[model samples]
Target: MSYREERRADQVAERAQDREDMRLKLEAQLEAKKIAAEEKRKDSEAKAEQTRRDAEAKRRQEQADKRARQQEKERNKAARRAKYGKVTGWLNRNPVTAFVGFVMVCSIVPAVISQVGALADAGVFVLLAALLSAMLEGTAWALTFMGKKAEDEGRPAGKYRVATWVTAFLAAAVNYWHWSEALPNQTWVAVVFAASSLIAIYLWDMKTHGSHGKTTEERREEKARKQHLADRRKHHKDIAAEADRLLSALPFGSIDEEEAFATAWRIKMGAEPGLSAEVYANATNARVALGAAFELGEHVRPELVRAGMLATLYNPLPNRLSEGIPTLGPTLPIPALQRSSGAATALAGIGMYGSEAASGNARENASEKDGGSTGGNASGNSPRGRSDEELEALLPKALKVAAELVAEGNQISAAALAKRVGIRRDDARRLRDRVIAERKLKLVDGDDTELAG
Candidate 1:
C-alpha cells in the first residue's frame, strides 16, 4: 500500500481504458467499410446488367441487318431468274414500245421532208403529230427503266417495242403519199434508220439485263403479271399514304414517348392519331384497333407487329413495283391469331420441303397421315417425324439464326422452338442452351421459373 505502488496501479488502469476506447473506434470504422463494400458490389452488378442488355440489343441489330441482306440477295436472284423467262427474248419487258419509238424516229424524218414541199397541208401536220407522239411515248417508257416501278426488264419491254413500230408505220405511209419523186431512196433511209434505232434499243437492253432473255408466251404472261402487280402496289401505297397523313396531325409535343409511339402506330395502322371514331369507322381504324386486341392475347404481344421495316417473311416487298402491284418485301406482319398458320409456317417451316432442311420429312409425313392424329403431333411429330439428331441439330441452327436475327431487331421465339426452314427442320437444341447461358434467351412467359441452363 505504498504511494509508488498505488500510482503504478492507477497508470495501468488508465492504459486499459484507453486501449478499450481504441478497440471500439476500430469496430465502428470496420462496420462502415462493410456497408460501403456491399453498396459498391450492388452498383457493379447493376452496371454489369446494363452492359449485358446493351450488348444484347447490339447483337440483335446486327442479326436483323444480316437477315435483310440475305432477303435482298434472294430477291435479286429471283428477279434475275424470272427476267429470263419472258417473251420478247431480251427485250420482252418493253419490246413493243421500243419498236414503236424506233419506227417513229425513222419515219418522222422522211414524212417531214416530204411535207416540207406542202407545209400548210392539214393531213401532213396531223400525220407529223401522230408520229411525234408515238416516238415520245416509246422514249418515255424506255426512260422508265431508271424508275423503281418498271417491269422486270423483260417481256413488258417487248410489248412496248411493237407499239413504237405501229407509230413508225403510220409516219412511213404519210411520207410515201407526200413525196413520190425520191420515195425509194427516202424509204430505204427510213428503213435503215428505224433498224439502227431498234439496234440501239437492243444494245441498251442487253447492257442492262445481260444476254439472258425470255420466250414469247413468257413475255406476254410476264406483262400481264406486271400489270396485276402494279395494281397491288397502288392499293398498298394508298393505304400507307392515308396513314401518314393522319399521324402527322398528332399533338404528342414530341417529348412524351408514349404519345410518340402511339402516333407512330397510327401511321402504321392507318388510324387517326387523335383516337377519333372517324378513323375507327374506317378500314385504317381496324388496323389501329388491332393494337389493343394484341394486348389481350394469350401472349402479351402487340397485334400490329413490325420488324425494322425491311423485307422479311413478315415483311416481303418488291424490288420494283409496277403501277398497281403490291411491291415485294412490304407485306404486313403476320396476324397473331394466325399463329398456327402464318407464324407456324414462317417460324417452323411447316410446309417447306428440301433435303438440306430438317422439317421436310416431318411436313410430308404430317400430310400423308391426313393431318396430325392428335393436336400434340405437329410439325415435328409425324409418324416418321424428326429424329433426335434432327431436333438437336435444329437447336443449334435456330439459335444461330435466331440470335443473328434478334441482333438485327427481329422478333422471334425466346423459347426453344423447333420448326421448319425451307425444306428442312432444325435438329438440335444444344446451341439454344448455350445462348440461354449467355443470357440471350428471353423467356416469353414471365411466370415460368425454369430457364435453359
Candidate 2:
C-alpha cells in the first residue's frame, strides 16, 4: 500500500509543475501585446496633436497676411483722397468756374443715369428717369423744327414754352408706363399735363410780358434774348441725339473695320449732320487710325467737289518741291477705299486728322462751284450774296410780326397794321379781330369807327 500511494503523489506533483510553467509563458505573452498596443495609441495621438498645431499656425499666418494687404489698400486710398482734395480746393478758389463745373456735373449725372436706364428696361425709377429725358429731348427737336424760320433768320429763336410742355408730357407718360403699367392712363395724363403746361408757358411769355398798352422796348429785348438762348439748347439736344444713334449702331467688339465703315456710309447716305464722325473717331484708338476709309461715298464724283479739299488732295512733284519723293497729289485718282484690319494704320490716318489728312481727302467739300450756287435754275440768272447785317436788321421785325400772328390765332383782324408789318392787310385785320373776340385786348366802339385793343 505504501509503494502505490508514493508513485501517485509524485505524478500529481509533476502535473502541478507543468501547469505553473504554462501560466508564466501566457502571462509574458499578454504583457508584450499590451505594451505594443499602448505604444501605437501614443504615436497616433502625438501625430494628431502635431497636425492641429500646424493648422492653427497656418491660419494665424493667413490672417496676418490679409491684415497687411488691407493696410496697404487703405494707404493707397488715403493718398488718392488727399490728391483729390488738393485738386478740388484749387478749383473752388475760383467761384465762377467751380459753380459752372458743379452745374455741369449735376446735369450730366442725371442725363447719364437716364441714358443707362434707356439702354435696358430696368427698375421702375430708372425707366421713369429715362422716359423723362427722352421726352424733353424730343420736345426740343419738335420746337426746333417749328422755330426754324426764326432761328435761321438770326432773330429770337422761341421760348422754352414748347420744350417745357413736351417735357411734361413725356414725364407723365413715363409715370404711367413702368410705375402704373397703364398706357392709356399715362397717355391721358400726358395730354392734360402738356395742355396745361403749354397754356401756362404761353401766358408767361406772351401775356405776362405784355404791358397794358405797350411793352417797354427793354422788356421786348429781354424776351428776344431768352428766346435765342432756348434755341441754343435745342441745337445741343439735336447733336446729342444724333451722336447716340451712331453709338447704338456700333457696339464694342461687334463691328469690324468693314462693318464700321458700312455704318458710316449708311449715315452719310442720309446726308444729315455727320456729327457721328467726330464721336466715332474718339471711341477707340483702332477706329481713329482707320479714319476716312470708313467714311461715306456715293458713285465716284468729280474730285474737284470733295468737301472743297480737292486742291489739298492732289500730289506734288517731288522734284518741284525740296523732297525727291513724289508727294500726295490732287491729280492722283482716289481709289474707292475698302476697310482693312491693318492696311494703312494710324489714328492720325483715321481717328483724328487735322490739316494733315487733306492729302488723302478725295472729296471733303461734297461739291465745288466756279461761280454760282445750286439755286441757279429756280432763282433765275441773277445770284445774290447775303449780308448778315442786313438780315439781322430785317429778321427781328419779321419775328415780331410772326409772333403776333401766332398769338392772335383765328380771331386776329388783319388790316392796316398788317401792311405796316409787311404782311397782308387781311392777315392783320384777322389778328385784331381775334384779340377782341378772345377778350385778350380792350376794345372801344367809337359809334362811327370801332377802336380795338
Candidate 3:
C-alpha cells in the first residue's frame, strides 16, 4: 500500500509541472505579437505624415510659380504700353519729316551693323569697333532726338542738324576706311564712298525736311479729291437728316411713307447708276419743298413737282427726255403728252375749290365705270369691250397717271382725270378705281381722298 500511493502522487505532480511550462511559453508569444502590432501602427502613421508634408511642399512650389508668371506678365504689359505710348505720341506730335528721319536711322543702323560685323562679335576688336559704332550712332540718334524735340517745341533745329551731319560723316568715313582694304584703288574707293555718303545725306535731308515739289496738276487733283470727300460726307449727312425728319413727320402706321423715304435716301446717295450730285441736290430740294408744303397743310402742286423731280433723279440720263425714261412697268401710249396735260391741269386747278358733292359724284361715276358701264369707248367697244391685250397695254399708262396724281397727294377725281386724258369722266374714274384695286394701292389715312403706294 505504501509503494502504490507514492507512485500516483509523483505522476500528478509531473502533470502539474508540464501544464505550468506550456502556459509560460504561450504568454511569451502573445507579448511578442502585441509589440509587433504597435510598431506596425507607428510606421503607417509616419508614412501618412510624410505624404502630407510632401503634398504641402509641392503645392507651395506651384503657388510660387504662378506668382512668378503673373509678375512677368504684368512687367511685359507695362513695357508694351509704355513703348506704344512713346512711339504714337512722338508720331502724333511731329511732322512727316520726323517719320522720314526715323526710317532713315532705322535703315542706316542695320546697314552699318551688318557692314561692321566685328562690332557685334565678342573680342577686343569687337569692343573697339562696337565703341566706335556706338559713339557715332548714339551721337546721331541724340541729335535726331533733339531735332525732333526742338521741332515739337517750335525752336530752331539747326544745331541738332549740324551735329547729326558731323556724326554721319564720321560714321561714313570709318566705314569707307574699313571697306577700302577689301576694294582695289583705295583712293578712288574713298572718293566714291564720300560722294555717295554726301549724296545719301542730301537725299535723306531733302526727303525729310524739303517739299516734294509736286506739279500743279498733282496739286489740283489732290485738292479735288479732298473736296470730293467733303462733298460726299455733306451729302450723306444731309440725306440722313432729311430722312430722319421725314420719318418723324410720318404717322406711326405709314409704312408706305417710310419705304418712300428710304427709297429717296438711297436714290440721293447714288443707288442708281445714272444719278448725279446735281440730280440728288435737285431731288433733295424738291423733297424739302414737298415736306414744307405738307407741314403748311397745302398738299397738291408741291407734291407733283417733288414727284417729277424724283423721277428725273431716279432716271438721270442725258437723253431721258428724248428716249423717254424707262419705267418699272409697261410703257404708256403718249407719256410726254399725258404728263404735260396732267401737269397743266394740276396747275390750273391749284386754287380752285370744288364742291364736295361734285367730288362725290366723280367717285360714284368711277365706281359705276369700274362695274362695267361702257359709256365712253374710244376703241368703239363696250365698257368691257377692250380685249385683254388692249387692257394690259392701257393699264400701265393709267397706273402712271394715277401714281403721279396720288404722289401729289391729290384725289383721283373723274373730272380732272377725264380732262387730263381726254376720256369720259365716268370712264376715267372707272379706270382709276380698277387700276387702284388691281395694284393694291391703299387709301391714305383711311380716306378716299388720297392714295399711297
Candidate 4:
C-alpha cells in the first residue's frame, strides 16, 4: 500500500460523515416545524374557547336586560293604576272641593287670557302680556299654597294669606279695568269679568282652608293655647330684648323660646322666671323663718313649742340679722336658735312701754328667758345680759362697724348692729341711737320701727 491509497480511503470516510450530518440537520428542521404547528393549533383552540365564552356572556346579559325591562314596565303600569285609583278616591271623598277647584280653573283661566289679550290689543307684546297675567294668578295661588303650608307647620300664616288676597284683588282690578275699557258701557259684563278673578280664588280658599268640623274640646284647647302665648308675650315684654339677643347668639333650634326667655329672666332679674325680686325675697324670707321656727320647736320644751306655734299665728320674727353676721349668744342645746321668744317679747315690751321697761328688764336670765322659766335649773348665767362697762367697751367698735356698714351702703338697724358688734338687741339699739346722734347718720326708714331705743 502506498501514500495515495491511504489518502483515497480518508476521502471516502469524510464523505460518509458529511452525508450523516446532512440527515441529522434535515430531521431537526422537520421536528421544529412540527412543534410550531402543535403550538399554533393550541392557540387557535384557546381563541375559539374565548370567543364562545364572550358570546355566552353577551347572550346572558341580553336576557337579563330583557327581564329588567319587563319588570320595569310592569312596575310603571302598576304605578299608573295606583295613581289613577288615588285620584278617583280623592275626587270621591272631596267632591265639593273637587268641584270648587274645577270651577276655579274654568272661570279664572279664560278670564285671565281674555284680559291679557286685551293688553296685547293695546300694543303690549302678546307673549309678555300673557306672562304678566300668568304671573298675577300664579302669585295668588303660590301665596295661598304657602299660607296653607305655614298653617300646617304651626307658623303665622296671616301675612301670606293676606298677600294672597291682595294679589287676587289686584288681578280682579286689572280685569275690571280691562273689561270696562274694552267693552265700554257693558258694566254687567265688566263686573262678571272682575268677579271671575275674585270668585275663583275665593272658592279655592274655601276648599283649602275650610275647617273640617273641629271638636269643641279642640277649639277650647286652641283658644287656651293662644291665650297662654299672648299672656307669656305680655308678661315677658321686659325681658324680650335679652331673650331676642340670646335667640340670635345661640345656634338655631338649640334652645327653645321658653327656655331662652327663662334664661334671660334669670340673667336680668337675678331671680326665678315669672317671679319679681320682691316676691322672691319675701318667699325666701318666709321659708327661712319657717325653717327657724321648726328648728326652734324641735329643741325647745313642749310648752315653749306650743307657745312658739301660737306666736306664729300673729307676727313672726325676722329671718336673718345680716348677711355673713355671726350669732354670738351662748350655745344652748341648739346653737342656731340664738334668738329666744322671751328676748323678743321683752324687747317688744321695751319698745312699747318706753325706757322704764328697757331699764328694768334689760338683763334677763338666758335659760329662763329662752326656755320660759323652768325654776332653778333655768336660772343660769345671762347669755345676752351685758353690763354697762361691757356695753361701753362695745360702743366704739359698734360705731366703727356702723360707719363701715354706712360706707358699704348698709342701713344701720339694731339687729344688724347687734350681730355686727356681738351684743344684745336692746344694747345694740341704745348704741345705735348714740352712734346716729354722734355721727348724725340719717335713718333710712325715718324711724326705728323694729325696736325703739
| Candidate number achieving the greatest TM-score relative to the actual structure | 4
Model 4 per-residue lDDT tens digits across residues 1-453? 788999999889999889889899999999999999999999999999999999999999999999999999999999999999999999999899888888988888877886687678778898899988888988998998999899889999999989999998888888888888888979788788888888888887777677456799999999998898688778777687788899999999999888998899999888677666777556544433433333321123445644653453354446332221222111112212344444333222212112322223232322224323233222232656667777777777876776565444234555556666656666666766666454422222223332233
lDDT of 1 by residue, 156-268 (tens): 55554455445445544444444444455576654553344344444445455564589889999999988864664465565445434555665545434334445555666
Which stretches of model 2 miss by more than 4 angstroms? Answer: 1-11, 93-453
Among all windows of 10 consecutive residues in model 4, the one with the lowest summed lDDT is 323-332
Candidate 3 lDDT by residue in tens digits, 101-202: 666665566545633553444234766776666666677767867886897698998998898888778767765665565464666765554444345455
Instruction: In angstroms, give how far residue 201 of model 4 lies from its true place.
Output: 1.6
Residue pairs with backbone overlap in model 4: none
Query: Considering TM-score, where higher is better, how would the candidates rank from best to worst?
Result: 4, 3, 1, 2
Per-residue lDDT of 410 in model 4: 39
Candidate 1 wrongly placed segments (more than 4 Å): 1-14, 34-38, 41-49, 69-174, 183-453
As for lDDT, the candidate ahead, 1 or 4, is 4
Worst 10 residues of 1 by lDDT: 347-356
TM-scores, all candidates, are 0.24, 0.20, 0.29, 0.33
lDDT of each: 0.45, 0.42, 0.56, 0.65
Q: What global local distance difference test value does model 4 have?
A: 0.65
User: Candidate 4: where is the Cα deviation over 4 Å?
Assistant: 1-80, 216-453
